[model samples]
Target: MGRTMGLDYGDKTIGVAISDELGWTAQGVEVIRRRKPEDDMERLRQLSAEYGVTNIVVGLPKNMNNTVGPRGELCIAFSESLRESLRLPVSMWDERLSTVSAQRTLLEADVSRKKRKQVVDKMAAAIILQNYLDSNSKR
Candidate 1:
């Protein structure tokens, strides 16, 4: 089976997570610095190919009340772009508390605020992907 990728899309950075080839665990991969849409698409396409990823789980940032906002719209657009460019099944998962969880995790780990800023995105992506994996595994 091919691996799955997770994305935590943000305004400045897109955090990436990749599942193991066995499809068991999720690991934070890298944070892709956003430049242009076309360029980011190309980079993702390359990463997908490199990792043999066949599916994607992108985070959809929704308000706590479950309303889609501008950031959520951007995620939708990014998912659509990924589907078109990577030719993979790109799905979205609600990521309301992922960042909060990430922050808490960093705090518990004694990570400084500055360091947390650097790794929070990747950790959030890992959390997002792990949640998806667990949900699908329960099926």
Candidate 2:
């Protein structure tokens, strides 16, 4: 079966993660630098093909008050674009604290600040994907 892909969309980059074949866990892949929309789509298309991604999950960073903010709106738009361009089932997961959690994990592991900066986005993507997988597996 094809695996699920997770994306942590941001202003300057998109963090990527891929689920295992059994859909049990997620691993950080790479961080895609933002450029033109078409360029971003092309990169995603290539990654999808390479990883046999059948589904995509985009992180939606909502406000603490349970409302979608400007950032969340952007994520929704990105998710729509992914659905149209990739022709894959795209979903959004609440990721209000995903990045923060990633940062905390990195700190706990004693990752250097420079290294953490380089990898936080991808780690956040993995956190988002793992959260989604855990919730869905309970169903």
Candidate 3:
């Protein structure tokens, strides 16, 4: 089966992750610097093809109160765009504090600040994807 792709979309970047063939785990791929909507979609399309992605899971940044804010709305819009452009089923998973968790994991790994900055988004994407996979497996 093709892998599930995970995305962490932000104002400046879009982090990418992909599940293993078995869909048991996730790995950080790349952090695409955002330019234009079409450009981002094109890059995502390339990644999807390269990784043989069957589906997409986008990280939705919700507030602590479990309500979607402006960022979450943006993610929802992005996901809609992805569905139309990629013609793949797109799902949005709650991603509150995913970045924070990534930062913590990086800190524990003793990664330098500059290096962490470069990879944090991708790392967060992996975490978001892993969480989704784990939850689904338990179902």
Candidate 4:
């Protein structure tokens, strides 16, 4: 099976993660600096092909009450676009506390605030993907 990609889409930066060739583990890949839609999609297309990615797992940032909001709506739209452009099955996994969790992790790692801001996006992407993999894994 081809590797799966995890995306943490945000207003300014899009964090990227990739699953192992075996699709068992997720690792931080890169943070694509947001640009025009055309440019961003071009970059994603290239990355997908480079890694032979067949599936995309995007983080759905739902509210604490498990309700969809503007951000979640935007994510759904983004997922739809990705599905059409990439021609891959796109799935959304819950990302309720991923950012917070990532922040906590950064604190534990004693990452400097400046460094954490730079890397947190990618790290959050990894956490989101790892959760998906862990839940879907079979013994």
Candidate 5:
């Protein structure tokens, strides 16, 4: 079976992660620095092809009260664009505190501030993907 891709889409960067072929776990790939819209899509397409990704999971940063705010709207738009461009099934996973969790994990590990900044996005993507995988597995 083909793997699934996870994305943590942000204004400045996009964190990327990929599931194993069996779709049990997620591993961070890289952070794509945001540039042009087309550029972002192109990079996604390339990574999708490279990783044999058949599905996509984009993190939707909802508010604590479970409301979709402006950031969530952006994620929805991005997911739509991914669906249109890649012709793949795109799912949005609620990621209310995925980034915060990532930050805390890094801090607990004693990761340097600079290093955390460089890797936090991808780490957050992995957390998002892992959470999605876990929830889906029980269904």
Candidate 6:
């Protein structure tokens, strides 16, 4: 089976992660610094081809009360663009606490502040992807 890609799309950067070939686990790939939408789409297309990605999962940041705010709407729009560009199924996963969880994991691992900042987005992507995998497996 082909692997799935996970994305944590932020204002300044997009975190990328890919599932294992067996679709078991998620691993951080890299953080793409946002430039232009076309540039980002090209980069994503390249990564998808390189990693044999069959689908994409984008993290959707919602408010604590489970409401979709502006950021969430942006993510939805982004996902739609991805779907149109890649012709692949793009799904949004609720990522309310993924960033916080990633921060805690980094802290527990003794990662330095500066280092954590560099990798937090990608880590959050992994968390989002892993959560999706786990939930889907239970069904």
In Å, residue 5's CA in model 1 sits off its true spot by 0.3
lDDT per residue for candidate 3 within 90-136, as digits (tens), equals 99999998999999999999999999999999999999999999999
Q: How far off is model 5, as Cα RMSD?
A: 0.6
What TM-scores do the predictions have?
0.96, 0.98, 0.98, 0.97, 0.98, 0.98
Find the 10 residues in a row with the least total lDDT in model 5: 128-137
Model 1: per-residue Cα lDDT over 52-131, one tens digit each? 99999999999989999999999999899888888899999999999999999999999999999999999999999999
Q: How much is the lDDT of residue 98 in candidate 4?
A: 85
lDDT of 6: 0.97
Estimate, for each residue in 1-139, the C-alpha lDDT of model 5 and write its tens digit. 8998999999999999999998999999999999999999999999999999999999999999999999999999999999999999999999988999999999999999999999999999999999999898999
Poorest 10 consecutive residues of model 1 by lDDT? 38-47
Question: Model 3 off-target regions past 4 Å?
Answer: none
Residue-level lDDT for 113 in candidate 6: 100
Worst 10 residues of 4 by lDDT: 130-139
Give the TM-score (vs. native) of candidate 1: 0.96
Query: lDDT by residue for model 2 over 1-139, one digit each (tens)?
Result: 8999999999999999999999999999999999999999999999999999999999999999999999999999999999999999999999999999999999999999999999999999999999999999999
Superposing every Cα of model 2 onto the true structure, what RMSD results?
0.6
Q: Which lDDT tens digits does candidate 4 get at residues 1-139?
A: 9999999999999999999988789999999999998788889999999999989999999998999999999999999998998899999999988889999999999999999999989989999999998888864
Which RMSD values do the candidates have, in order? 0.9, 0.6, 0.6, 1.0, 0.6, 0.6
Better of 3 and 4 by TM-score: 3
Worst 10 residues of 3 by lDDT: 89-98
